[model samples]
Target: MRARLPDIAPAGSPATAPRTFLRAALAIAVLLAACSGEPDPATTPARDPDASAEGQAGPIISIRSDPETSAVPAWRAPDVPVDAGNLAQRKQEAAAALEADELFGEADDAIPLYLALREHAPADADVATGLERALGAVLQHGDAALAAIDDDRAALRRAQEIAAVAREVAPEREAVVEYLARVERADAAQQANRSGERALNARKIVVAGGKGAVAHFREALRLRPGDARAMQGLAAAESALIRQAELAANQDDYAAAEDWLAKAAKVRPDMDTAADARERIARQRASRVGNLRDLGLAALTREDLDAARRHLATLLRIAPAGDPAAVELRRQIELASHYGLFRPGQAFTEALDRGGRGPEMVVIPHGAFRMGAADDEADARDSERPSRNIRFDRGLAVSRNEITVGEFRRFVTATGYEARATRRGHSTVYDERSGSLVRRSGVDWRSDYAGKPAGDQLPVVHVSAQDAAAYAEWLSEQTGHEYRLPSEAEFEYMLRAGSQSRFPWGDGAPPAGAGNFTGALDESPGGRHWRNAFKGYGDDAWGPARVGSYSANAYRLHDLAGNVSEWVADCWHDSYRRAPVDGQAWINPGCADKVVRGGSWASSPEQTRSAWRLGSDRDTTNARVGFRVVRQI
Candidate 1:
C-alpha cells in the first residue's frame, strides 16, 4: 500500500476535527477489516471505494482526524456519466473518451468510465491499464490548470474542478495532494486580494492594530509570496496612503501629512513611489506655507500688525522649522512697525515723488563683523590696526552700483545743485597720454577718467565727498527716505562681502572674473601696463568700466572692491582710538577728511585687500574716486 500524504487545512482552520475523530474511531472499532479489491494497476487504490457515497454530497475539505491516515477526500463524480453496461462495452467507451482527450472534468472523460467498472471487475487487465492511464492523464491536467491559475486568476475555477476529480480518483496520491495544495494557496491569495480591495474602498488604509488594506495586502503576500495580484494590491494601498498625505498637505495639516508619507514608505520600501509622494507632499506644504507668508506680509504692509502676527503664527505651526519664508515674514512684521519692510538681498528702486525712481538698491541684513585686519596679515597698515567688531542692528539698503552719470544728472537737474567740482571749475582727471593724474579746469561730474564727456552708464568719477552728500540729500528729499553714504564700518563690511581673506576673492591670485583690478596684462590706449600689478591678470581696460562692469559680491553690491575707490560717511580717523562700534559714521564737528573704502583700477594687489582703507579730503575729486548711496530702512 502507498503511504498516505497529509491534508492541507485552511488558515485558522482546526488541525483536526475532534468530534469527527471520536465518531470515526468508534466506527473503525465496530466495522470488520475488509479485503482489498483489484488493487491499483500500477499502485494502491485511492481512498476506500465505499467513500463514494459520502462524495455524492459534494467536494468537501478532507479532515485530518486520523494522524496515521492523515487523509480522507471522497470527491464528487465527474459531470458526464459513462456507460455502465457489459465489461467489454465499458472498456470500449473508456477507450473512446481517452481518444477524445476527455480525461477528467464535466465532459465525458475516461476516468469516470474506468471508475464505474473498477468495482466489479477490479481484477481485469483492461480495467487496470485503463484506470492507470486515466489517473495519470487527469493528474497532468490538474498540474497544468494549477500553473495557469497563477498567471490567469480566472483559471482558478477550472483548477478547483480538476482538484475535485483528482481527489475522487486518488486523493492520497502524492501528485494529487500537491495539486490540491497549489489550488488552495491560489484561492487563499485571491481571497486576500478581494479583502484588500474591500478595505481600500472603505478607506481603511493603514488603520491602527493591523486591520486595514495594508493588513489585507500583507496577508495576501504571506499566502503567495511574490504573487502578481498581491503585489498589485499592495501598490494600490500604498497609493491610497500617498493620496491621504497629499490631501492632508492641501488642508495645511503638514504634520499629519508627513505621518501618512512615512507610512507609505513602510508599505513599499522597494519602490520609489513613496519617495516621489514625499516630494509631492513637501511641495504642497511649501505652497500652503507660502500662501500664509504672503497673507502675513500683505497684512503687515497694510499696517495691520495684529492680523499679520496671527497669520505668521499659523504659518509657523505648519511650515518646517527655520523656514525661509516664515522668517522673512517675521522680519517684515518687526521692520514694518518701525522702519521699512524689506528682505535681505531684495532689490528694488525707490519711487520719487517727482514721478521718477531712485537708483536700484539691494536690501542688506544687519549683522556684526570684525572691522580691521588681524595682526599677522601681510602688508597690514597702522590705520587698520586693533580690529574692532561693528554691529548694525537695523537693516539698510545700499545702491547696487556707484551713482552713474545719468543718475546724478537727475539729482542735479531736479535740484539745480552745483557739485563742489563744478563750482570750483577744476577737478583731477587721469592723463592716459602721460600716464599721470592731472588737475583739469573742465573736469567735473560730467567728465570721465580721461576728462571727456562720460557715458551715462559709466560711473561719474570726478565727484567730491561733499558733492556725493549733496546728491544724497537731494535724493532723500525726492524719495522721502534718508539717503546717505554708507558708514566707514558698513562700507568695510560690504567690501568684505562676508570674507576675511587677504583679497576680496581670496588669498590666492585673482581668479578669472575677479573684477577690474590692476593687472600686469592690462593695456591702456597707449599700451601702458602696471609695473607692480597681478601677473597674468587683466580686465583689458586701463580706465574704470561702466558702473557694473564686474560681477557683484555676495551682498549684490557691484564694484565695491574694484573699478574705483568709493567714499564713506565717516570722517577720517588716524587710528582705531574711540571708534564707533555701532556701525554709525564716526563724525566730529567740522571734520574735513572722510573715509574711503575699496580698490581702484590703479591699485596694486595688496591695496585690493578687503581691509585696505584710505582717508581723503572732503573736497577731493579724482578719476579714481566715485561714490554710491545708502538708504536707512
Candidate 2:
C-alpha cells in the first residue's frame, strides 16, 4: 500500500495524522503487490460468473494512519468514490510533502521523493524531463559511488560510504548542473554585498598589494568601470617616480635621474613635482659642464694638453653660449685655440680685459729673441739647455701690476661667470730688504692679503693660464676688442725690452732695486738669508707685495720677471727648434703641454733670464702666476 503521513516518527516507525478528508496516494509497487495472488485478466474470472461477480470481489481496504502510533494503518476512498480509471489522478497530491521530507540523506536521496510526487505534478513535458534527468544523474553518481568505495567498507557502512563518495566525486564533475538553482540565489547576494564602501576599500587594497600594484590598478579600473581610487593611486605612483629621481640626483646619477623625471612628467603634465624635476635636470647639465672645467684646468696644469682639449670640448658641447659660465667658457675656447681644439662652426668672442694699472706700459715689443738656456747656465736641464731663437711679428700689452679682485668684479657682474677660489699656491710674494722671495698662503685673488688694499689695478696673482684666458676673453667681449693671451715670444720680447744682454739690465747678478731675488740682506755676516718667498717671511717677508712697488722694466713693464709667471699661447713643444718662426702658437693635433716664460718675482736672478723657460699646467692659477693680452696685428 502507498500512504501519505505528514507527521511520521523518526526512522523507527511511521507517524499518525488527523485526516478528516485526506487525499490518498497509491504506488504502482503497492498495486502490483496487492494483485500478485489476484485474478488473471485474460481468463475473465470464469468461476466468478457462477457466484455473481460483484459479490465475489474482495473487500476494498483503504490504508490510513494508526490513531496512537501514527503508523500507515489503512488508506481508503469512500465506497461511492471508487473509480478505477481516476485512481492515479487522486493519488498524486497527497504524496508530495511526505516524499520531500523523507529522503533527505542518501546518494540519490531526492529520487524517491520525486517518484512519490510524480502523479500529482502538473502535465508539463519540460518538468517531466527535468525530473527524470535529475533522477538519472543521482543514479549515475550512485553507481560511481559504489565503485570508488572498497568492498569491505561498503559492506560495513554502505549508506555512509555512498554519501561520502558522492560529496567528493559528483560535485567536481557536474557542479554547474547540480547547483544551477542554488547559484542564482548566491549570485544575487554577492552583487548586493559588493556595493558598499568597505567592499570598495577592500578592492583598492587588493589592487595595490604587491610589486605589480600599478598594473593591478589598471586592471581594477577595467573591471569596475569609473573607479576614482585607481586613478588617484596611479597619480601617487608618478610622484614616487619623482622621489626616485631626487635620490638619483643626490647621488649624482644624472642620466638615471633624468629618465625617472621624464616618466613623472609624462604621467602628470600639470603636477608641480614634474616642473621641479625638469628644472633640476637643467641645473644638473650645467653642473656637469662646470665640473669638467675644473678637470680641464687640472689637466692643462699638468701639461696634458690633449686631455685638456678633450675635456674643454666636452664642456662647450654640453653648455651653450647663453650659459652663465659662457664668458669663462669662451676663454677656454680661446686658450684651446692654441691647441687646435676648436672646430669651424664655433664663435670667438673676446674675454674680459683690464688695462694695466701702473704707470709703466711694459710693452713686450715685436721681435724674435733667443728662447732656450745657454750651455754654462746653472741648474739647466736637458729640456732647457738647448735654447733656440723664437720670433714674434707682434708685441703684447701687459699689466704693470697684478690685476686685483676689484677689477675682476666688473667682469663678473657683466658676464655672470663663477669665480673659483682655492688654496693659494707658492708664487705671488716678493722680498726687498734681503733680496729674497717670500711665499705664503692666502695670496691668491680669492683670499684677502693681510695688510694689502686688494685694489682692482693690482695684478690678479694666483691666476692659471686657463684662468687668465677666461678673464681675457670675458674682458674682450665687454670692451669690443680682440684681447687674448700673449705668445711666449711676446712675453720674452717684452721682458728683454730691446736689450740683447743676458739679463734685462746686464749679464751680472740681478740688481737688488731692479727686482725681488733670493739673497741675504746687506751682507751682514749671515743676518738673514732668503730662500723662496713662498717658504716664509724673512728680510723679504712672505707673500706678494702691492703691484708695481719695484722699478719698472726698460719697456716700462712693472714686476714682469719677479712678481708673477706669465702664461703663453703656444702648446709646449719642449724645444724651440721646430717651433713656428712666424710668431704663432705651435699647435699640433697631438701636443698637450703649455709654456710659461719670464720667471716670477719668487725665482732666482739667473732663473729670470730672458731665455729661461718654465713650463706649468695650463689649468693652474696660483698666487704668483698671471697673464697679459695682445691683439693680432
Output the worst ten-in-a-row residue range by lDDT, candidate 2: 25-34
The residue-by-residue lDDT of candidate 2 on 1-633, one tens digit each, is: 232212322322322321321323221111111233232323322221011123323211112221122222231212223134643442342234224432223222333334333434556454365445543453343343223222111111222222333343233546434442232222222222222212222222122233232454445455434433345444544544554455555554556667767666765466676787668767877787778766765564455767767777666666656654544434443454343332211223333345433222233334456765577765565666466677654344555554556666665565665543333343334444544435555455654322233556455665666666677786566567556777776666677765666677777666666655444442222454444332221225234445667777755666667656677787776667666666666666544567777766456655767777777666555555666665442
Q: What is the lDDT of residue 86 in candidate 2?
A: 46
Candidate 2: regions farther than 4 A off: 1-364, 420-444, 448-457, 522-528, 532-542, 588-592
Evaluate candidate 1 by giving its C-alpha RMSD to the native, one decimal. 16.8
Tens-digit lDDT track of model 1 for 323-349: 988887887777665445666667899
Query: Which residues of candidate 1, in runs, are more than 4 Å off?
Result: 1-152, 200-210, 243-255, 280-294, 319-332, 340-347, 350-357, 363-395, 400-483, 492-574, 580-582, 586-627
Error of 2 at 478 (Å): 2.3
Report the C-alpha displacement of residue 93, candidate 2, in angstroms: 99
lDDT of 2 at 501: 69
lDDT of each: 0.73, 0.48
